[model samples]
Target: MIGTWVSILPPLIAIVMVLATKRVLLSLGSGILTAALLVASFAPVETVKHLWSALTVSFWADGELNTYNIFIMVFVLFLGIITAFVSLSGGSRAFADWAVRHIKTRRGAKLLTVFLGLLIFVDDYFNSLAVGQVSRPITDKHRISRAKLAYFIDSTSAPICVVSPISSWGAFLIGQLALILGTTTAVNYSPLSAFLMMAPMNFYVIATLAMVFFFAWTNIDFFTMKKHEEIAQKTGQLFDPEKEIPGQLKEDFPEHNYGRVLDLVAPILTLVAVTLGMMVWTGYRATQSLNIWAIFENTDVPLSLVTGGLIGTLLAAILYIAQMGRNETASYRLVGKALSTGVKAMMPAILILLLAWSLTYLIDILETGPFLSTVVEKSNIPVNFLPVIMFILAGLMAFSTGTSWGSFGILLPIAGTIMINAAPELLLPALSAVLAGAVFGDHCSPISDTTILSSTGAGSNHIDHVATQLPYALIAAAIASFGYIILGLTGSVWVGLIGVILSIVVLFTIWTVKSRRQIELTT
Candidate 1:
């Protein structure tokens, strides 16, 4: 059961239950318990121990503190506090008022988010949270749904990081590629060169990014997303007030009349600057090298996050304090309230994150990833369909395990080995398909950390984010699958690229026409 088909059941059950009940903690708990039972061979005492270990390991592991998990959790709490402080300082209201006066339209607001998402590609976690902080006020001002904002954040963060050579994702993947290609004497390209070459071949990233811009510029949405957008536009409600919004402040702070846009911009800028600087400094310290790529590859990302978050949080608090004498609304008494509200706002996200991590830990113990990769390894599929098959398998593996990095670790070597032996010419395309599929699946998986953070950043209900984003992800995935098929069959990246572009054009054209007709009918 540990490394066989039975290992797949827990994730499937979790996914199905979450979708059916929309109770994230309960679903994740069920999955965790199921995996623990299986790992403990259905012995009650052993299952309890496994569960305890899983929960404890999130903070303490291997005779030491799990700094990575602790730092990330601390970052989340810091972000929440920053949001509360920003609002208490009247930065949120002031920024939204400024944006409404300048941006003037929903399209401008949405496109602002798109551009911000693209610009912040250093790390997906940072991108997700930062973009939401900047864009949420603007988008909410224009009545864009929280789900839609989450979609924008989710689409831009991972896809951009995966492609950008300077990003944390790029550094990690390059390291993985070095190991994968090191085994082969036939491949002549360096890991960095291979990564750059494979970037254009990642059709899912291309499709997803294109869809993001299309939706941003045209304001077209479908399925659950369309419903969310309509509700927002008609009612001026960003999300259902009744639902659990992970990062939404439970207590509303009074806005200061003298609040300025600088109040909002300064703290966010401080966060981004500090985080990027720390990433380089930490990486340089670790490697003792001046090389930019080497620095990124060895950077302590979680440490950087907490460092930046602490600075940002302090700056936000200072800003509120600075307003004490100038603004009648500002008071020392409200400082404690803001801190408490901020922590309360982030509690839901923290709990969900912990549960998701626990379940992922149990899933790893189950060897679920290897089981899925094993199935792909032993398949006797034709060479022409290998790219598509790898794409699907990688997507499934990532979707089940809720981690694209995990999928990359397990699948890249397998795909490389398979293609190196079967057809060396198709190696890059096959590997690109795996990368694309992992992002696609991660983009859709409810339990994915990036996905959860996107929801948190946008202040949306987690299930709403997952539900609204799924249809769009599936559409992009379908286009990517077609592109992979063409690449595999023709053995040409250019032809495959054309196929992806054409598919997007065709789908967008049809969707546009149908949307116009529906609008005409409504009018």
Candidate 2:
């Protein structure tokens, strides 16, 4: 029972199924089943039966799709409903139309699209749909590919949220930190400070945004993209501009008949304000109750995000109905219809989540993390170079797993423990490395939820987007790796900070030069 063959089979099966069929659910499900079968093969019949029973109970009842899993699904549905209502009331469209009227140039359109992504970091799901839906029309107007729009949306999703301390991601990170800090102490190591510290070190995110800005300002793209832009310019149809909306978008779909932009902008702003205010209030309470904080900190984030999103959506729905001049009671029907449409739009995400969770559970049951960690330790890597090795390992694990949170959950605690033990000074940098690597892998993995949502949002071929994005991610990763080495040796934040800045400047310059040449040729 070496089980060596078992180790490799599941992922191989998953990859083949995904590449061959392009069916995400099938691939993920196949991966889970394969792992289970492998585990069973190694155990005696009686042992196998017991293992199966335990694994099933753990996976279904306490695994990824258990309590928190259900919450995220419900939240996504709620978000969908809110978005649907906003669109139905011409709020979303109104905002888009207004942006179009104000920002006329193609360059400005791309810049504004990126800006929208950064602004909507409250939640990745919201960032995905809101930015995608709002910017699609503008990107179409500028002849930007849906692929590019998806790139912007995907880059902004977790990257922005992870760095923003007040976002849903921020709340979650803070809660996790609180637990690790033993919750009762009023420690200075706030999740907010951690985010701020790492923001400068988040080279991938910073570089990607710089690329977007450079391209928008100069119109430069690498080899094939430039050609695609040229062809789009000549033919006027490189990317399909088809607008798919829940029945709600009909009135504002074409944009010409949409209401004033403020109708949309006001509600969205209100949603942001209310959500942030609630989070602040919740955070304050968590800080005040030492006992309750210790017990509730672990659960606060998902709870808060769901509640905040629901409240924001409720407010949006009210405003939508108010715009229709209907009595509050009469407006229930509109809200109901919008809710139905919204939940329907999120059906795909809901299904994917279940399958993804199942796959994650299977991996955990197989003890993938410990197995992988053992392999890395055996590689005889130097203690000093371990941070760099961990960075690469984190990326590989995340890409294979297709879940950054899973990657972080498995690797962070281990890496943190090891770093603190090895070079106490390197604790923060090592933590940042784990975070960066996880994000990098998630950024490019085709099976990643964020990646899938990005493709769905941009309407790009999933594989193509993954393939195109890999280069950018790898480049940033290479630079980040070098930064990790410098930090490990010098033990100074400035080394990594300077490295990140240099990487962004160099990448942005390349983007600028290529874009300017393309624009001149197009003109």
Candidate 3:
């Protein structure tokens, strides 16, 4: 089954089961077991061994600790603790009251979230959690649904990071592009220049970002998102109370009378500042150089995340303790309870993330990504259609593997080689297509870590987030596909960009006309 069509079954099964059952863990478990059985040739004992190995690889791999996964998990826990302390110190309530006063409408709240999401472009992981923590109170005050908040966070995090040269995603992709360009004599542009050139050529990012702004400003929603929004507006319920919400505190703590907005703003600022500083420090240590791009390229992102999370947790804890002197409801015992509650709040997200990682690991071992890449490499498509074909294939690969980075690793070089041999002029556009498609698939994939984090950050039910965001993602993807086709046919980035903008404008115009008709009927 490895490196064959059968290798695709596990992810397909997992995705179908998740949508059908809304039981994330069970669905992931089924996929893991199925993949193990396939790898073991249906032998029960070997399957058990494969399953154990797959599960533990996230903790330990290649005879050493897997610092990347472990540190990211630690960061998630620390973030949860920070949130608990902030709430315990009454920062959440204080911030909500302040934001409600200043940000008078739901549109203001949504646009605020969009701004935060775009502002925090250093890393997608950091962007998702930090933006959610800062914006959730304002959004909640204005009756914005958790699913909608997750959508905003998800849309901005990866799309912004993928284009920003200073971001973790950009650093990684640039490194890959350097290697890819090194192998070809046809391309003369430096890696950094090529990355900058590809930025505008990433049609999906433009389409998705445009839709995000439009949705935030107009509050136009459809499918499951519309239902979630309507429920929130009608009853003040941000999510279904019955569903399991990750990163939501189960126990309510007493609010201090003297709490201020500074209680919330200070810790978030510390987290962001410390994390970015550590990234530069770590990068400088590795490269003994002063170039900003080189620093980002060499930075230890997971280490920076953990360090910043620790400092943020400490600051939040100190803020809560300071409330003891001024507020009658503040108590020493609640400090211990806060830590426990914080850990408990993040358990659901952690479990789902671990399962998703395990499944992704097994999928890699099955060579699903390589198999998909092989299909694209072997296709004898016309040069004019190569960009769109690569976009679609890259999307399918990332969707099946639940990891855009994996698709990038596997497909980028291939895209470079194909375009260089077929038409060197289309190389950047083709490469940009891969990046856009990978993000598109990541947005739609239920098992994607970024998707899971966005749900956790927004305190939304995981399945609800996935379900609500799919329609919006598909709409953007369709527009991007049209744009890629235009780019392939005309060999002009500007024309493709115009095509994407026009597509969005036409769609929104039709939607607005239909909306007015519906309003007239209702009235």
Candidate 4:
């Protein structure tokens, strides 16, 4: 961090370029080039060399390729394959057909979507795609907008995983906390305990969940959603058929009424069962602990996901292909085609993920985290105001990087160090602020994987999802900031609940006013 402020330039440049151009890949590439140039001491020749090496090497560094990166990518690929196979076999269509029969109303369709989203809490990536695959038709039948469907997918995905104790998100977060805050002498900060303490104070997660239910209950559609719903009603259009669905959204519904609703339910159950079993077994083996939390904290989570994905994918292929044909020979051929097509479909998302990882590595090399910590330590800000400050600043970091996990890695340690060294009692509030801010920012970011996947799943345009969801995410952030301040001032999560209640009330009031205005405008 030789140029302390320069360290911030990479992510800031990424953010600005994204807003200006909407080309996330180009923006990330430019940011990487700028950061690499800075890293190479601003020498032109060295900078070019650094840039080439980054493009060729860092994006798939052997270290990460062998261990962590490969696992994430592999799981995504297999998940894609499973989703594809399920769709081609009429599992998704069959389920939707069954659902629309019973769930005749718009409200029931939306609530069912929400319920399904909440049910698939094992991983956000899995949750987003799975819910979208199953629920899109149901929602479309009931005239729900793609924007609204995308919102439901995005809202439930990350926020639920952030607080879920047994999720991959939780495991990864625990690893970060254990690595960073485990050094403290003042507090015994086991990763699980830290997460537990901050859970109640995670106001944004709670508020976002509440906001979705509000939307479900009241059937509020303001902004672009109103127009979308109108078009859907008039034209029976589920998506913009003219504008291509940009990513791995190849949906060809062949008439395969052979499948039952159980075809969908069975595969999802197999995925869940295999994933949870592997997670527990691996965790227990690693830690030799009967305690589930300890087991979760100790598991080789990334590898477990890969294994689970592989097994679940295999089971899905067997179940789907078996039902697709009269003989095993034909089914085997179908499996081959589906697997190849599905994995290939995921290539776009995989490429984006690779670029994201490369950018994250560059930010880490620039020591951006330490620079941020320096800013916090040097500021003469009051202790109570610090929570709000941390919340806002962390949002900036996550928004820039498009990764809550990366921002969490940077901020959690800094917060812990500050708390132990100067303000011990404010530990819970500060931790809460970091977690809440990271999720809120990533929840809204256009380039974020979760956000991108939500759009991918719903087949909504990415910019549309970003434009529609950002306002709501910002509202959640504002409320979380207020909650953090209350927690800091009162030293109790109970008091912070007041801030949460107020945030929901404000949102509902706005919805009320917006509905009245819509009525007026129509008149």
Worst 10 residues of 4 by lDDT: 324-333
* lDDT string, candidate 4, 474-521, tens digits: 877878877887887887778888878876898799889988888899
Per-residue accuracy of model 2 over 178-225 as CA lDDT, tens digit each: 444443233346655655776666555666666666666765555445
Best of the candidates, lDDT: 1
Q: List the residue pairs that clash in candidate 3.
A: none
lDDT of 3 at 520: 89
lDDT of each: 0.94, 0.64, 0.93, 0.76
For each candidate in turn, the TM-score is 0.99, 0.78, 0.99, 0.88
Better of 2 and 4 by lDDT: 4
lDDT of 1 by residue, 1-523 (tens): 8999999999999999999999999999999999999999999999999999999888999999999999999999999999999899988889999999999999999999999999999999999999999999999999999999999999999999998989899999999999989999878989999999999999999999999999999968888999999999999988999899999998978855877788788999999999999999999999999999999999999999999999999999998899988899888889999899999999999999999999999999999999999987887889989999988998998899999999999999999999999898888889989999999999889889999999999999999999999999999999999999998888899999999999999999999999899889999
Q: What ranking of all candidate models by lDDT puts the best one first?
A: 1, 3, 4, 2
Candidate 4: where are CA atoms >4 Å away? 1-3, 42-45, 52-64, 172-194, 241-248, 251-253, 323-336, 490-492, 520-523
| Location of the lowest summed lDDT over 10 successive residues in candidate 1 | 252-261
Error of 1 at 386 (Å): 1.2
Each candidate: RMSD: 0.8, 5.4, 0.9, 3.2
lDDT of 2 at 2: 23
List ranges where model 2 is wrong by over 4 Å: 1-5, 19-21, 42-60, 63-65, 120-126, 165-199, 223-258, 281-299, 308-340, 455-464, 489-492, 514-523
Error of 2 at 468 (Å): 3.6
